[model samples]
Target: MTFTFKKAVRSESKLRLALEGISGSGKTYSALRLAKGLGGKIAVVDTERGSASLYSGLPGIPEFDVLELTDSFSPEVYVDAIHAAEEAGYNVIILDSITPEWSGKNGCLELADLYSKGNSLAGWKKVTPLHRKFLDTIVNSKCHIIATMRSKAAVSMVDGKVKKVQDKTEQRDGTEFEFTVVLSIDRDSHNAVASKDRTGLFKDPEVLTEETGKKLLSWLSGAATISPEIQAEAEKAAQLGVESIKNFMASLKESKPDQHALFSDAEKKRLYVVARKADINATQQGK
Candidate 1:
């Protein structure tokens, strides 16, 4: 294979941010505030039972759309919702408490347990791909993403005294590396400290607000360029035949009518073509 290189340059990009905190640390509100600052049509995938909705019409909080996930927390379910939101033209999407996707009922953990059937290692082997796909969906999404993760209080014994400390985030380990920014929020003051920041905007711990998002947006604005992954997907979709795309759309309309209804005609055609390409690739690999 031949190799080629080009001068590296920064381009305007979507945000992949994660907020980590215990309950009452104001992660949901903080996400909304940051989204407000980012300045776009926002959508929230609420896994916390309408918690994000409670903040609607509050001071400094802009109006936004919400899609509540009551029971199902599967990765595919989340992926479909994200696609729907992206098709609907949301500029930013808040995954309010991604914790449930990792640990809640019908989540990855439970799915692994069911798949493993008494073999833990074997179970994760089957489930890891699903989890990775979830991560990839987040990473490659065209819209900016703000995901909230729940953390527990860590306690340590210091000189025979139990001291409470901030716990690690509650999702899969190493999940922080996926985001451009990861903020750890204080429970009492709700001030956020950057555990990880690729942007270099937050140097000191401060209260998260709309300004924080605006700063991020300002930093993110640059010369626009298509990402290699998106470009590749588009190229693959272009290679697919119109008849195949139509067949996939017809199948989707029959099998997933509700999800099918979420897409516009153009989006439906594009999505079906891309999905068909993915299916063909998977079949080829299997063969």
Candidate 2:
């Protein structure tokens, strides 16, 4: 008997980073440093009051193009700008703020909790084919992406002391943590850490000062040479993270543990068919 197999499409080694935290945490500073260390070629989406000017004096950086509100504030604008950057020969692309670009329309609010909406998966649906251009040109354009997000902070009184808390911000103005290297920038010596990488190893909560950015750049520099064993671990984490989300959404549609409310009974039953295909893909990818 003869067996036939098709060649696999190779994915490029690219970096997608999200800078999260309080205002004035120096997210841009960190991104520029990362870019500087990675061979002096970088692109930035200057949404944060001209993120370009914010770092004009930084080492190894010459100048940056402003992400005009009229241009990228709309989703279509994002596609145009990213495509232009890819063609302009920048080795790294920076989206200064991704939240303002997302207009909460056509069920965009549903993805308020997932990274797809802005930086997560469900946000992907909100933007649709329009956003796919971003994923391809920005994510797959053979360049590093350093996106800065305006952090949405929750406030609560802990023992009568009002404290600002960090959580998933709203979609229209902030991004949810899910599918990138999530970093919480704070005004101090400490910064919160969350890794949402599906294609690479993820780190845990660690302090992110200027020093942390240097370490990340070092790791990113070596990502192309990651060990096979480590690669397996990262992929598993990615799958587990995405799978957990699917199950969470499924549970919300149920009054009974095994029942779904959002979809018709017939539609819910078809999940098994999709799930079987996912399993096969996972196995082939060694996830």
Residues 1-287, candidate 2, lDDT per residue (tens digit)?
99999764323345567776666566677666656544545677766566567668666554555555433365566667777887888777777766665543322333334446346656555555554444455555566777776666777776798767656643433233323476666545444555355423334444433333333444444432334653344334334444643564454434222112212222323444455566677788895
Q: Estimate each model's TM-score.
A: 0.73, 0.55
- Best candidate according to lDDT: 1
lDDT tens readout by residue for model 1, 1-287: 99999765444478999999988889999999989878889999999999999999999998999999987998888888899999999999999988988998888999999999899999999888988888999999999999999998887776797755578778999888899999999876788998998876666777787757766765676412234554454445545645555665466457644333333334445666666777788779889
In model 1, the runs with Cα more than 4 Å from the true position are: 1-4, 155-164, 222-287
> After TM-score superposition, what is the CA distance of residue 198 in candidate 2 from its true location, in Å?
5.3
Worst 10 residues of 1 by lDDT: 257-266
Give the clash total for candidate 1.
0
Q: Which RMSD values do the candidates have, in order?
A: 21.2, 18.7
Residue pairs with backbone atoms closer than 3 Å in model 1 (clashes): none
